[model samples]
Target chain A: MAQIIQIDRPVETSKSKNVIRKTMSICPECMKILPADVFERDGKVFMSKVCPTHGEVEELYFGSYEMYTKFSTYWTDGKGALSPNVPIDKCACPTNCGLCSNHLSHTGLGNMIITNRCDLTCWYCFFYVKKGLEGAYVYEPTMEQMTAMIRTLRAQRPVPGNSMQITGGEPTLREDLVDIVKMIKREGINHVQLNTNGINIALNTDLALKLREAGVSNLYLSFDGVTPKTNPKNHWEAPYTIENCRKAHLGVVLVPTVIKSINDHELGDILRFAQTNIDTVRAISYQPVSLTGRMSKKEREKYRITIPDCIERIEEQTNGEVTKDDWFPVPTCSPVTHFIEAFTKKPQYELSIHFACGAGTYVFEDADTKKLVPITKFVDIRGLLEFLEEKTEELESGANRYVIAARFLSKINGFVNKEKQPKGLSLAKLLTSALLKHDYSSVGQFHLNSMFLGMMHFQDKYNQDEERLQRCDIHYVTPDMRIIPFCSFNVIPEWYRDRIQQKYGMPIEEWEKKTGEKLEQRLYRGTLRRNIAKHEMNQMACATQAAHIEPITGT
Target chain B: MKYVYEPVKGLERTCIRNISISSSSDTVRLDEPVDFTVKLSVAGGIRDAFTSDLWEKAWDAWDKTFRMTYNIGIKKVVAGPITKDVIKSQKFVRRATFYWSRSPELNPDYSKKIWVMVVLEGREPVHPKSVDEAKTTLFDVKKTFRVMGSDLGKGKHALKAFGKASWGRHIFGEKGNSQSVSKEITITCK
Candidate 1:
């Protein structure tokens, strides 16, 4: 608590073609840190930096300046980590990124890479190992190492990291994956999720049930799109994977790596698919592709898509059912955390990251019309958030706790329009329970009725803003017992991910000989890519069964 | 990123022909919405770096050779000696990035209710260049803002209004603010 930093937020005006603020950015070609200007032109935000060696470079920082300024209003500086891994005197971000003292946010969700081995090889993926490459090694940590990493995450002060995402090239490829989940649960990770392409989960019917029984909460399934072209990774098997998770009573979050000229067009259909299987599908985490390495300016323009771009496209594709105004930045939840902390008189879990990094909203099915009802369409979300902020300020200013609680109870229902709210949905009551009881079951009840749509755009070298980097909340835990931000972990793999993993990792031959299992055997021959994909209800899940879903490509 | 704006003088070819300023109300009270319109008539145009043809070649040639602002309009190549101090200078810094000479009005504060700035100017629809002695164009910009409680006191106030053409923000370590045309009106604030 003593180490928590208070972020100074000054009012700024970023109208047309104005230097919104000055920040630090690295040159793409030279990687030299230089001062950069984040400004707006033609209603778009772009970052410009002048590298001493690389000269000058400008990249689109965000798509819409209007959305940027609106989101920036909720920009809340996070409570930085109390015990930093790498203690530094000065803030040298994107380097010294082992949750340094200057880092602004604690671990909201810590990822542990179980293995760098996958079933399928995607050209755009940088997580897996390449055979015959120099210093190529199978980066699978021992059970003891994983236990130590989970313990490190649990040791975080203020709010100990409880959510763990076990990610990898393919986590299910490891034979001891269920045991790993058991170990993470044994170490007090309440929510354990497996990040996988889901070929194994779809093929092995018992695996989903086994993992669920072993304390795995959900499957962070890699589901790009519903069609073959957009989701070549798991289009044929994702339906089976969803069915297995349904049977096992496990939740699944569909992840789509959206690219501008690529699979971005299917965003609407993907949301519909989630709604169709809303019983099992909890959320759709749309991740815009982070283009690493250097490339020509023309190439970047072809595939570059920012967060607002995705939300705008979703609005257009969904026929205006879910417009851009419905979505709020991820840090909008900070007010809830603040109010709860002030009420409980202790630090609570908070998602206080840069507002530009992500945005989200929840949608519930209408009882009568069966139409998707976005939370914003019914409730005054901005008004409620602003009210919560006001109440939190009052509580912080020495207002009576019980009086504030009574005032909060009296005022909560004013923000929700009862006529527009979905039937059987009482958001005011749900919020009341969440604030009073503060338990997982209240949130679980909320998740049972609606679907969360999230947009998280990871940064690359060209568009990296160090201000956002210093406040990143999604982190990765390494075997060295240090937590790393996701951008520094994979975006600059040569520095952190690869360097540390290779140190604690072993060669492919050595790993194979020790385990007596060939690395090639880990590859799934698409056994789940059998017939019945066309007959699957996933096509019906996107709710495009009548007009859009074609018989041939499962559109 | 540098927080500076520079003004280029001797653009005698471009000067404000006429200027006027007006407010929506003769008396402004706190939290009252008032529309302010500033109009200026001027000939010629401001220099824009992006529309210039040298923008592409300036990156490769910036370090080896420098180009001065006066010789920038035309494609004629004028060379200057490369000095270490020149690289760190604000002029060189302005040349690389987009530091334009826009006819932007002054912005005092944003906590006011609303501010709508409208500018009327002309250029080629595609790749417009600053004309040295082009047609005289009329610029009318309006901003609707509310008087803040913290800004005004209960008294007779003289509101100084000026329709001037200057660099926006004027942060380039310049000596004094460049002024073109102006007027003042009296208003009572309560």
Candidate 2:
């Protein structure tokens, strides 16, 4: 007989305390729309919803109510997509969402899933071969279908999305991956990024060079933590992958899927690793694991971590190097977009996402102390934003162009504190050049001096908010040429990703017979023995030197 | 009698003298009125680039160009919430304000008509009433505007007020002038 475990429990409930706001969420069991109340308890914000069939479900929404409210102040509604695929009068949100008119933002980063066939079956991954095994189909879109999808994305009006991310079960597994990149570039997408595990890049020496030559601007490398135990997926292979990326001059952004009690403890070490490898690693993006599949409330509570939670962890782990106050919501850059639109009299790329969806801040390395300096340490970011807003409003009100420009040049010095500025960085001059002269070269200089730190928390059915769904700017383009938001596609895979991919996929039996390999046999085991051996040799050399070794002559 | 003319090297060129802003109080009650003064000074001999007749012609051309291109009209007003009849009636006065009040070349008469638009918590632009002015070597204009209690709600608010000098057409490489000074004020609702 199984052993039974019992623990102390308190059942008294008068009235749930600290209700902050009311929103809408979905039932995890029945997937029904339900009224949800957001409240604070134990310093964490949580969403509680009661479904008629599912009973009561609660999930942590934000780690800190104070931080949530502080970031909420930056909220601004976006000028939704032009030429929405669905009419607002016909249907409600989420149900009619191939980017219905109810959506508040256009697609900023469009994702194209080329193949739903990966080489690794990670325990936490949303996409793997198991889905195909269960459904009896292999989801791999044809090149023609991919081209059509890219066309559909570029055809989006008001502002045709200029950036696209090629994603997959593993995009690098495709033999024609370079050709796909070429095709995307041919379609006139300026920024083409690939989301991949670094195993392929590390194993194939010429592959990184080929991708770079094919115009793959950036690689969204999946790197969880520094230690091998914490990141068994790619810890042993990351160094070689990063070195190959450096050799190819391809920029990489470290993407860590942080789960509490698993890899969350290693965030500070991961950040330190990123700083040391800043040349190849452009940014470190933390994604708190979302409970997409079947999960109990207790399991959800144990695993779920929000953006603020990640930020707080980063602060604690980095020993206050990156504090909560240093970060701002992703949508804080909306003013820059607004100003550009007003000045140029054209539609610009707008990031009008919900403030709670993501937060980011840039950290520059101080020349004197060699320590990372948060942008707010030197530049008066809030003051600069206010100034930009004022200037944009003035421009909209028909302010004289020459006079505004001259005044901006003269008063730019007042907004920046020279004494607090980073060593060898003339922030005032950089701001003046970027804002007044519209010279973006200074922005490149700024990036060269700093690294971007950001975190994005995707939602599952347990905590999905309709408001967030309406404001999502990241979308996935399907083989059928429909644009669905990321959370909607992943969270409710049955309705969007699975349904669409099944229509275009082949039967699993046929795929196995034709490919002459079973699904389980196709998983990627690393083949970069030379690079791994070199890395091991370097580590051994360092260890020997640390022990003060001396070479012996012929004895 | 005229002596041999000699050109001086490194002679100082005409430029803007100074721009300054001051508020009546650092803190104000919500839904109450506050006043601000903006002063602009132009260096001497800056207008030497043009004769009086040429300057007048340039000003006229600038005004005509501005009116033709950007003058807010019935169609544009209709695009906003205000109705054409309401605008046509004496019920509303819709005038374009300057970008920056401290531009050296801004017309003094135009600057007098300019007002400071106070934006609080992303609300509608509040046009302040011009109370006083002293135009000399240094041009000064004082204006007042009210902040709504609802805008502040509670606690502290960042009150951003800027003098907008709208000259219609492009001037000084931009459309208008806006003072760069922003003030933060704590508002206590009564």
Model 1 residue B33 distance off true place after TM-score fit, in angstroms: 12
Point out where model 2 deviates above 4 Å: A1-17, A423-426, A432-438, A529-555, B1-190
> Cα miss at A515, model 1 (Å)?
3.0
lDDT by residue for model 1 over A515-553, one digit each (tens)? 898877867676555544645544533234323432223
The true-versus-predicted C-alpha distance at residue A408 of model 1, in Å, is: 0.6
Candidate 2 residue lDDT tens string, B1-190: 0122222221124333344434466555666654434333323332232222322333222211111111111111223233233111011112221211211123222121122222223222222333222112112223333334444454543333333223222322223322232232333444
| RMSD list, candidates in order | 16.4, 17.0
TM-score against native, each model: 0.73, 0.71
lDDT of 2: 0.65
Off by over 4 Å in 1: A1-17, A531-555, B1-190
lDDT of 1 at B55: 26
- Return the DockQ of model 2: 0.02
Judged by lDDT, which candidate is best? 1
